[model samples]
Target chain A: MKGLLPRLIKRILGGIVMILVVASFTFFLIHLIPGNPVEAKLMQLETAGVTPLRAQIEVQAMYGFLPHQPLDIQYIHYIWQILHLNLGQSITYAGVSVTHLLLEAMPWTVITVTSGIIVSFVVGILTGVIIAVYRDRGISNALTLFSTFLHGIPQLILALLLAFLFTTIWPIFPFGSPYDAVLTPGFTLPFIGSLIWHAVLPVAAYAISSYGGWALTMKSSVISVLGDDFILASELRGLKPRIRIGYIARNAILPLFTTLTLSIGFMFGGSVFIEEIFDYRGLGYMLITAVGNLDYPLMAGSFLIITVAVIVANIIADFVYTAIDPRIRT
Target chain B: MSAKLTDRSQQDFGLSPEVACQVRDLNVTYRVDGRELSALREVSLDIRQGQITAVIGESGSGKSTLALALMNAVSSPGRIASGRVTYRGLGEVTGMRGEELRRIRGKAISMVFQASQNSMNPLTRIGAQLLDLARSHDLPNPRAVLREAGDLASRMSLDADRVLTSYQHQLSGGMRQRVGIIFGLVLKPEILLMDEPTTALDVLSQSSVLEIVRSIQRERQLTTVLITHDMGVVAELADRVVVLYAGRVVEEASTAELLRHPRHPYTRSLIQAIPRLTGDPGDAKALEGQPPSLASVPNQGCVFRERCPYRMDVCETILPSFRFDGDGEHRFACHYEEARHD
Candidate 1:
C-alpha cells in the first residue's frame, strides 16, 4: 500500500507535466498565428465602413491584445488566468466568454468523440481477435486489406464520402447540427431522437476513420502474443477456445490500451475536419472558427480543455492497465 | 473418472504393463524456408510406468521435439510426419483429434516445459491459473481443486497460500518452476513430461526441485519422461536413459548400465564431457565442432560421423541400425558395437 501510493502520486504528477507541455506548445503556436485579436476586430469594424480607431484602443485594453509584454510573460499570464477559470471573452463571437463558449460546445464534442472512440475500440478489438485467430485464412487477409484501405483514406475524404452517402444518397440522417432547431431542448424522446439522428453521420465518420488503425494494431499485437510461451502452455493445457482467447487478450490488450487512451485524447481535439465537414457545432467547430478569426483566448481555452482530457484519459488507462496486468503493478 | 477407475482395476489385476507410452518409428519434421528438415528421424522409444526416463541431448538434438510429439502438441511447420505416439491404452495420440486428444493431454499426460517459469501467464494470478487449469479438466468443485493444489504445494515444501495467491512475477524462478511442476502434476497424470525443468535453476534450487520431483514420482508411481543435456542430472534422477544425436536415438539402456558401459561413441563422448568433481580434470573432453543442423544431416549415414572418433568406412554410406547387447534392452546404433564395452 505504501509503495502503491507513491507510484500513484508519481503517475498523476507525470500527467500534469504532460498537460503543461501541451499547454505551453499550444500557447506559443497560437501566438505565432499572423494577426492579433485587435487587428481582427479592427478589420471587422473597417469592413462595416467606419474605422473605429478609438473602439480598437478600448478593445485592445479590454482584451490585453497590445504587444506590451514578451511571449513568455503572456504565456504565464494566460496560464494564470486559465488557472482561475478565466479564458477571457472571444473576439470571434462578440460578447461571448471563451470559457462559456467552450462549456457550450464541450458536451457535443465529448458525446460524439467519446462515443466514437468507445464504438471503434470495441469493434476494432473484436475484429482484431477474429483476424488473429484466422490469420492464415482468406477472410483475415480480406479484412486486413479492407482495414488498410479504410486507414489510408484521409479523414476529410472519409467524412465527405460518409456525408455524401448518408445525406445526399440515402438522405436518412440530418447533417447540419447536433439536432433539429424545431425540437425543444429537453429530456424528451423527440429531442434525444433528433440529436442522435443528426449525430449519426459525424459520429460514424469519426468512428470508421479511426477503427482500422486500432484493428490493425490489435491484430499484430495479438499475433505476437500468440507466440509467447504462456500462450503455448495454455494450448497444451487444452483450454477451450473461448478461455484461450480470454488469456491471449489479457496479455495482448495491454499495449493496445496505451493507443486506445491516446486515441481518446487525440480524438477529442483532432476531430476538426469531421466537425467542419458535418457542420456540427462541437468544440472542433468552435476551434476552427477561433483559428480563422485569430481568437487566441478561445483557441487556448479549447486546447487546454483537450490537453487536460487527453492527459486524464492516459492517466486513467495507466491505472486500469496496471490493475489488469500484474506484471506492471510493481 | 471411468478412465481412472479402469487404470486402478488394471493395476489391481496386475495386467497393466509397465510401459506408460509407446513411440513407434516417430519422425518429426520442420519446414523452414521451403525446406523439409527432419527434427526427429524414425525415433522409437518407450516411457516405462513408474520410472524416470531421461532423453539426454544437446540443443537442436530433437529432445524437446520428442517431448512435444509425446503430447501431440507439436506446433505447425513442425509435424509428426510418420509413426505413432501411443499413450498406453489411451490409443494413438498422433491420430487422435479434438476432445479425445485434449482429454489425455492435461489429465493423463502433462508436461513441464524448458524454462517452465516463462510458460506461466504473467497477467494472471497463480491461484486463478491453477483454478482455470483444474476447471478446464472438469474438476467440479473449485474449493476441492484449491485444497488439492494446496496439498501438492505443501508436499513440495512450498508455502501453499503464498505461492498460490501470488502472480508469476512475484515468485522466484524456483518457485515459478515448482508452480509449473505442480500445475503439471495437479490432475494426477499417469505420465509427466519434464523438458529441462531444472536447467535454468541455481544449484540449490535445481537439486531441491529434482529431489521433490523424484520423491513425487516414487510416491505416485508416475512415469516421467525427462529431457535434458545435463548428464549429472540424468545420473541423479533418470532410471533409464535414451541418448539422442542429430534427432536420432544413438543409444538406450538402464541409466546404470549406460553410464558404466556406454555402447555408442556419442554417448561415450557425452559422458566424458561431464566434469567430475573428484576424477582427474584431464579426463574432461569437450566434443569438437557444432551439433549437426537438421537441414544438413546426411540422409544415408551415421549422423555422428563428422564428430565420431571411430568413424568406419561403412559409417559414411550406411546408417547403423540398432544392435542390441545380450539382454536386448540395451541398444546402440553403431557398427562398432562389440569393439569396446568398458
Candidate 2:
C-alpha cells in the first residue's frame, strides 16, 4: 500500500496541471468572444444615470482590468488573482462576488446530480451483474435490451418525457423550482420534502439517461470476469454459490470504481437542460444564464470550479483504483 | 460398452492395485458451428490408488478432457456426451450435482488446472483464498486450514509466510504453481487431478514442480491423475502410463513395460521420437504430421493409422480394440503383432 504514496502524489500533480490548462483555456476563450461585456455594463449603467467617472471605476473594479490592456498582462493578472482564490466580481450582478454566487448554487446542483448519478450507477451495476450471470436466460436478454434502449434516449428528451408524464398525466410532484418558493429555506420536513419533490423528475432524467452505459459497462466487466480462469477455478473448487458470486463481484466491480468516482466529480456542475427545465437554480442553471448574458466572471468562475472538481475527482479515482487492484499498486 | 475392454486390459496387465477411480465408456464432444466434434470417444481407464497414473497424448488428443471427465467437470462447449465416471466410494460422479457434487469435488477429489499460475483470483492473498476454500467446504476451524496450507507450502520448499501473504502476481511462476498444489492438497483430498501442471512454466521451473508433485504424491500416497504430452515427465513421476490417441486409450501398462515394449505404432513412434543423449541423433524418429483433430477423427477405423507407419488395410476398415499380451497388465490397441518394435 505504501507504493500508493508516490503514485498518489504523482496523480495529484497531474490533476493540478490539468486544472491549470483548463483554467487558462477557458480564460482566453471567454475573452475571444466578440463585443465587450464590460462596455455593455458601462453603457447600461450610463443609461441608468450613473456618473461617467463612476461607471469607469465600476467597470475597472469589477473586471479587475480594462479590456484594452495588453492581453498577456491581463492573462498574468488573472492567473495571479486565481492563485489567491479571487474570482473577481459578477458583471451581471453589480458588486456580487462570483465565488459567493457559485457557492450558493453548488449545493442544489450537488443534491440533484450526485443523487441521480449514484442511483443510476448502483442500480445499473446490480442489473448488469444479474444479466451477465443469467446470460443464457430470457430475462437477462430482455433486461439488457431494455437498458440499452433506455441508454439511447438523450437527457433532454428524458427530462421532457418525464416532465410530461409527471406534470400532465400524473401531476403529483411539483414541476418548476427546487422547492415551493414560499417555503423558507430551512431543514424542516415540509421544505425538504418539497425540495425532494421538485428533484424527482430531474433526477429521473439524469439517472435514466446515464444508467444504461453503466449497466452495459458493468455487464461486460462481469462477463470478462466470469471468463477468467480464477472464476472457473473457484467453481471447480466447489465454492458455494454465495462465495463464488462474491469472488466474481469483487473482481468485476474494480474497474467501475474509477468511473464512479470521476463521474461524482464531474456531476457537481450538473447538466444544463435538466437544471434549466426544472429552473432549479443549480450550478448548471447559473452556467446557462452566464453564457446567455455574456457575464465573464460568472462563466469563468463556473468553469474553474468544474475543472477543479473534476481534477480532484480524477486524483481520487487513482487512489480508489489502486486500493482495489493489487496488480496496479506501483 | 467399454467395461469389457477395461476388464480385458486388467487381465492382460497383471497388477491388481486397487482402483481409485473408474471412467467407463466416456465420450465427450464439443459443438462448434452446429457440428459435433468428438473430444473423447469411449475413453475408459482405471486410476490406481496411491499411485500416479499418467494420461499421455498430444494436443487435442483429449487427455485433458479425460482428466475433467473423472470429476465430471468437463467445461461447456465440451460436454460428457455419455459416460459413467465413478469414484471408489462416491459411486457415479456423473450423477452428482450442486452441493453433493461440490462437496465431493474439493474434499474427495481436487484438481490442479493447466495454468495453475493464472488459476487464482489475483485480488486475494493465497492465505485468504485457502481459507475461503476451507469455509466453502464447511471445514471447521478456518485457521487450521491456513496452518495446513502454510505447512504444505513449506513442504514444497516455498517460504510459508511469504507465499501465504503474497498475491498470485507477486509469486514467481514456480511459486504460484506450488501455491496451486497447496490449494489442492490443503483439503487433504483423496484424488488429485493435475492437468499439465508444468506446461506453463520454464524448463527449470517445470523440473522443480515435477519434483514437488513427486515428493508430495509419495508422502501422502495421494491417488493422482497426471495429464501430460511429455513422456519425460511420465518417466520421472508416473507409476502407470496410459497412451491416448485421438480421444481413445490406445495403450496401457506399467511405466517400465510400456516404455520397453510399445505395441501401438503411435506409441512406438512417440517413444522413438524422444531424442536420446547417448544414441545416434538420426535414430530418433520424429512423430510425422499431428494427432487427428476432433472433427477429422474418423468415425470408423483406427484413429492413429493415418500417422502410424505400420498401417494396414484392416486398420482403416476396422478399429483395433484392446489386445492382451505377455504380463497381463500390459495391453495395447493395434492390428499389429506384439513383436513389432523400433
Candidate 3:
C-alpha cells in the first residue's frame, strides 16, 4: 500500500494535466471560430428589429467586449469565469445556466449510448461465435452479406431511414424527442419508457452500423484461434463440444475485449452525428446548441467529459488485459 | 485385474488373449480439387490387448491416415470410404455418443499426435485442462482425480505442482507430450493410437517417453497401435509390424520374424533404409523414388509395381494376394515370396 501511493499520485496528477490540456485545446479551438457570443447576440437582436447600435452596445457590455479592453484582460476574465464554473448566460435559452442544462440532458445521452453499446456488443459477439462455428454455411454467408450492407450505410442515413420506416411510414415509434411532455419535470416509469421508445430508432441505427464490424472482427479472431493446435488438443481430450467451444472462444475473444473497450471510448465522440440526426437532447445535441449560440463553457464541458471518458476507457482496457492474461500481469 | 491380463504378463511379450481393435479392408480417400486421392487402400491390421502394433511406413504411405481413421477424426475433404473399425472390449458402457462415434474416442480409445508443442492449451493451467477431461467423462471425485494426475506427473519425472500449475507454454515440448500421454492413460482407454508420438522429442526425451509408454502399457494392459516412419522405434517397441506401401499393407508379421526374414521387397528396402551402427558392407540397397501420387495411382495391379526392383509383367497386370509363408501369423503380399526364398 505504501509503495503504491506514489504511483497513484502520479496517475491522478497525470489525469488532471490531461483534462486541463484537453479543456484548453477545446476552448482555444472554439474561440478561433469566426463569430463570438456578443456578435451572435447582437445579430439576433438586430434580426428581432431592436435598434442595432443600442443592441450592439448592450451585447458588448454583457460579454465584457467593450472598446479599449485589452486582450489579456479579456482572457483573464474568461479564465476567471471558467474557474468559477460560470459558463456565461446563454443568448438563445434566456437565463439558463449552461451547467444545469447539460446536467439535465446528460442522463438521456448516457442511457441511449451506453445501452446501445451494450446491446450491440452482445449481439455482435454471439452472432460472430455462431458464424465462426458454422463458417461457410448459408446462414453465415447471408449474415455477412446483410451486415456488410448495413455497415456500409452511414449512421445518419441509417437513422433517417429507420425514422422514415418506423415513424413516418409505419407510425410504430415516436419520431423525435425523448419524452412526450405530459410527464415532464419529474422522473417516471412511463416517461422513461417513452424516452426509450423514442431512442430505439437512433440506437438501432448506431447498433446496426457498428455490429457488422465487431462481428467480422470477432469471427476472424475465432476462426484463427480455432485453427490453433490447442483447440484440436482440446477435442482430442474428449471435452464436450460446448466446453471446447467455450474454451476456444474465450481465448480467441480476449483481443476483442480490448477493441470493445476502445470502441466505448470512441462511442462518446461518435454519438454527436447520431444525436444531431435524431435531435435527441443528449450531450451531442447540447454541444450543437451551445456551438450555435456560441456557449463556450458548455462546449468545453462536453469536450472535457468525452476526453476523460476516452482516457479512462484506455486505462480500463490496460487493466483488463492484465486481469484476463496472467502473462501480462507478470 | 483380469486373468487374461495376468496370463499375458506371465507369457513372453506377445499379443494378449483378447483382441482390442480390428481394422478390416479399411480405405480412406481425400478429395482435392475434384480429384479423389486414396490415402489408405485395403489396409487391415489388428491390435491385441496389451500389445503394441506398429504401422511402419514412409511419408505419404497412409500411416497417419490409418491413425486418424481409428480416431474417426479425418479432417475436411478426407474421410474413411470403407471398412469398419471394430473394438472387442469397448462397448456401450463407455458412454460414447450415438452418431458422433464418440464411443471409442477418449473413453475406449484415445490418440496423441506428433506435434506436442502445439497440442496443449497455452492459456489454461495443465491441472484445469486435466480436470476438464476428467469431469467431462464423468470421472468421480475430481479433486482426488487431480491429485492422482499430479502423482502421474511426478511418475513422468515432472515436478507435480509446477506441471499442474503451469500453463502449456511454460513446459518443454517433451513435458507437454508426457502430459498428453498421461491424459490418454488417465482415461484408461482400451486402445491408444499414437501417431509419431515421439517424433518431435529430442533423442533423450524420445527414449524416456518410449520407456514411460512401455511401462504404462504393461501396467495398465493398454493395447496400443503406433504409427511411425522410424524403423528403430518399430524394432524396439512393436510386437508386430505392418508395413504399408501406397496405402496397402505389403507385409505383416511378428516383429522378430519380420526383422529376421522380411519377405516383401518393400519391407526389406525399408529395413535397409535404417542407418546401421555397423556400416553395411553388402550392395548399397535403398528403395528408389517417392511413394506414388495417390490421386493418379492406377486402378489395378500392385501399387508398388512401378517402383519394385523385382517388377515383372505379372506384377503390373495383377494385384498380389496376401500369401502366408507357412508361418501362420506371418503374411506377405508379393508374387515372388517363394521365388525370393529360393
Which 10 residues in a row give candidate 2 chain A its minimum summed lDDT?
A262-271
Model 2: how far residue A40 lies from native, Å: 3.8
Off by over 4 Å in 1: A1-81, B1-16, B155-157, B338-342
Which of the two candidates, 1 or 3, achieves a greater TM-score against the reference?
1
Mind giving the per-residue lDDT tens digits that candidate 2 earns over A187-262?
A: 8999999888888888888888889989999999999999999888898899888988888998998988867876
Task: State which candidate has the highest TM-score.
Answer: 2
iRMS, candidate 1, in Å: value is 1.2
Candidate 1 vs candidate 2: the TM-score winner is: 2
lDDT of 1 by residue, B76-168 (tens): 989899998876656677998887777677788899988688888887778888888877787778667778889888977799999888989
My TM-score estimates for the predictions, one after another, are 0.90, 0.92, 0.84
lDDT of 1 at B101: 73
Error of 1 at B120 (Å): 0.6
Q: Least lDDT summed over 10 consecutive residues: which range in candidate 2 chain B? A: B8-17
For every candidate, what share of the true interface contacts is present?
0.63, 0.79, 0.47
Badly placed stretches (over 4 Å) of model 3 are A1-21, A27-101, A184-188, B1-16, B91-100, B276-287, B336-338
lDDT of 3 by residue, B1-342 (tens): 357635633542332356666677888899999977899888777677688999999888888888877776777789878776666644321123433454346766788877756777766788888888877776767677678777778888989999888887778778888888777777778788898898778888898889888988889878899999988899989898999988899999989999999999999988887776676746546678878878757678878887888887778778888888644789998876755665
Error of 2 at B125 (Å): 1.4
